[model samples]
Target chain A: METFQHSFPSRPLAWPADRSWALAGVVGSGNLEVLIEPNPAAPDAVAYDLQTSIPGYADSWKAALADFAAHYAVGGTRITLHDQGAAPVVITMRLRQALDLLTPAQP
Target chain B: MSRVPYHELKARERLAAIVDPGSFAEILPPPARVMSPYLPKLGIPVAFDDGLAIGRATIDGKPIYLAAQTGQFVGGSVGEVHSAKLVGLLKAAARDRLPCVLLIESGGVRLHEGSSGEIGIAEAIRAVFACRAAGAPVIAVIGSDIGAYGGMGILSACCDFRVMTEHGRLGISGPIVIEKWMGKAAYDSADRALVWKTSGGKTRYLLGDANALVNDDTAAVRAGIARLLGPASPVTLAAIEARQAELAARLEQFAAVTSPEAIWQARGVTDPAAATLDDAETFVASLAPAAP
Candidate 1:
């Protein structure tokens, strides 16, 4: 098992007032889950705390998350990931799904 | 996928088939990422919903809380998080006065997590009774091949009603465990017929352990549940005494019997072979109801 923490600078979040947190995916074989919750203290940073069953992938995880943080307005949220050897595509998809569920859609 | 047998469907698929269209709302859906913290310690894969998918849904426009265990993951075992989810759901059902349905396909507690799983199942059982006391029906659906074993079998017994299919087996000890302890000659696990006769849905129903036996179809299982949705069986002193006497009488009546066929014959099943081969409807119709 491997555990790490990393934070990335990103645009501030446009969180919905009705919701504070959202979760996505399940941690199973070759699958992972992403949980995103509001963090008022870190208004301009997205914190990533991850624990994976498969070790030695910290560099890959950091790269993937950095890319997600750069692309999305996920600032002011704490994202925690529990991974079980999910592919890069699955990880990104779960992150996007969690974020989509967190933010309200435009009418 | 709609043609797929209920016993073959996955946890999510089962939920989709049983609940009303577009009415299912997961309480802590997969997105919640509530993975088990202990699995990683043992170098095992963790499931986001801890191998149990629980949510709220309407059955025939009536509200209910539903839980389905994923047999594909970890043999649908119950761990700390999984059992806690069950307990929470049952308690919520009691508080809300809603029926709770458990689609059980587990081999009971997760041995890896040890005592936590056991304690969680115990807590869930207490919650089951709590729901009963609050006039909320708790239904156990055991239609999968994995069936319910270990503490889960006891938990199923505690529910207000049990809906089982021919593929479902409910017992404390599985055939393999019993064979290991009692030796091959005493109990041959390889003999599927004898094994099923001992603990399968047909045997359980005949023994009065399972309330209803349905076919291996989602529609049949759903219908069985629908029939029992009106009101929960109240747990009164008279009911408890009657149940105790019934169980004791069952033990004494079958004490000298070595084969399931003997019990079937004693129960007025003229041809045990025909009874075993018949489908759920025919099998149920052929049997004599238990004496009051």
Candidate 2:
């Protein structure tokens, strides 16, 4: 298993008032779970704490996370992910899904 | 609109679908970071909820404690953290006099964690009885393809009531373990129909093990759980004695039975062939008055 933490600069996120945290996906073969929570301490960046069962993919994970931070308004959030050999595409989708759960639904 | 099968949903999804909308407040949620310490050293991925999602919730506006195990994660095996969460929830339920509901989907103890899990299950069983003694009900809902096996099966039996679906199964050692030990000729695990007939909801319900059997849909499951709620039936010495007698009689009557079909016939299933095709609703409706 490989463990790492990284923070990327992004715009401040407007979190829902009633929500504290949100989660997506499950930890299993070829899958992962994304847990997103409010991190008021870091208001202009998205922080990540990642643990993956398969090693030697730290570069891929960092690149994908950087892209997610740049594209999404996930600043001021701590995203912790547990991966079980999930592909880069799956990881990005799970991140999006978690953010969706955290944000308030649109009318 | 088509409904999602209760068995096919994940742990959190099951909890959300069954409980009252927006009522689930997780006790030690994923953000709490109470994860398994043993998995990291073993090169295994640790889930945020430790493969078990436990929290406080409501059903039909009545406060209750709820738990759902993730079968996809290590077969929903109970590890140290998972069992501790369960034990804590059950203990809290007893203290608060709130009904505790468990959505069990475990293969057994996490062999990875060794005796720690076994001891954890034992402690959890004690907590279950503590709730029962306090007049706080402990309900087990086994409505998943993984079902409840091993120590979880014993814990389910210890609960006040069980709500099961046709997809649910309840047993000690699963069919695969039996087949692996006793050979295919004795108990073929590959025989899916035989496996279901052996420990499935229909057989358990007919034998009076499972209290209620509903459809596979989440709506039906929620309704089934709601119906079993309210006051818990008191456990007494007389009830235990009667249950023992009933089990003894059942064993003596079917001691020589080999096939599930023969057992069904002996249980007053007049048309065993037709009974095999019957769903839960039809099976219960077709039961003769003297069957029990």
Candidate 3:
């Protein structure tokens, strides 16, 4: 088991006032889950906390999360993930899904 | 016509088949991250839903609470988080006055998590009775090949109704465990026929243990659940007394019987072999009415 915590600088998030949290994915074999919730303390940073069954992939995880933070305006949110050897592509997809669920639909 | 086997369907697929189209809504779906923390410590992968999926759905437009255990994930064992979800769901059913259905397919407690799983199951059992007390029917659907064993088998018995298929086997101890303790001559684990006869749906139904025995099909299982969704059996003192007497009579009447065939014969199954081969409908039709 491996655990890591990192925070990425990001623009302020335009979160909906009604929704507090959102989640995506299932942590099964070759799968992972991402949970996104608001963290008012870190309004200008996106906090990423992860626990993975397969170790030695911290570099890959950091890269993926950095890319997500750079692309998405997920500031003032805490993102936690439980991974089970999911590939890099799946990790990105789950992150995007969680973000999509967190963000309110456009009119 | 060949169809997809019920046991082969995934947890989500089973939910889709058992409930009304597009009515199923998950409570704490996979994304909730309410998973077991013990599995990763033991180098085992943790499932997002902790191997149990609980949600609200409707059957025939009537609301109900439902849960499905994923047998492929950790053999569908109940760990701390898994059993907590079950307890919470049943409690919710009691609070909402809704029927609760469990699509059970577990080998019982998760060995990796040890005592936590056992305690969790005990807590879940208490919640089962709580639902019954609230007049909410708690149903166990044991149709998967994995069946329910160990604490889960006992838990299933505590429910108001049990719906089983021939593929399901319910017992405290599995055949392999019994064989290891009693040697080959006493009980052969490899003998699938003997194993099924000992704890299969047919024997349990004949013994009045299982409430309904249906075919190994999703529609059949859904129908079985639908028939039981009306009202729960009231758990009164008189009802308990009658159940106690019936159980005592069953024990006394079958005390000396060693073979399942003897029980089958006593239940008016003239040809046990033929009855075993019959489908659910034909088998139910062939049974003689119970003596009042």
Every model's TM-score: 0.76, 0.94, 0.76
Model 3 lDDT, residue A54, Cα: 92
- Candidate with best lDDT: 2
Q: Which candidate number maximizes TM-score?
A: 2
The digit string of per-residue lDDT tens for model 3 on B1-292 reads: 4555677777877888989998889988865778888887787767678889899999999999999998767778999999999999999999999999999988999988989999999999999999999999999999887899988999999999999988888999988999999999989989898888889988888888889988888888899899999889888999899999999999999999888889888987889998889977678778847622
**lDDT, candidate 1, A1-107, per-residue tens:** 88889999988886552476776776667877677888879888999989888999888988999999999888899998878789999999999988987886722
For residues B124-231, what per-residue lDDT tens digits would candidate 2 score against the true structure? 999999999999999999998799999999999999999998899999999989999999999999898898888998888878899888888888889989988888
Q: What is the lDDT of residue B259 in candidate 1?
A: 89
Off by over 4 Å in 2: A14-18, B288-291
Candidate DockQ values, in order, are: 0.26, 0.88, 0.26
Clashing pairs in 1: A23-B31, A23-B32, A24-B31, A27-B46, A27-B48
The CAPRI classification for model 1 reads as acceptable
Ranking by DockQ: 2, 3, 1
Candidate 1 lDDT, B1-292, residue by residue in tens = 3545789887877888888888888888765677688888897766668889899999999999999998766778899999999999999999999999999998889999989998999999999999999999999999988899988999999999999999999999989999999999999999999999889998888888888999888888888999999899999999999999999999999999898899878776789998888988888887646411
DockQ of 3: 0.26
Q: Which residue runs of candidate 3 sit more than 4 Å off their true CA positions?
A: A1-107, B1-4, B288-292
* Best DockQ among the predictions, by candidate number: 2
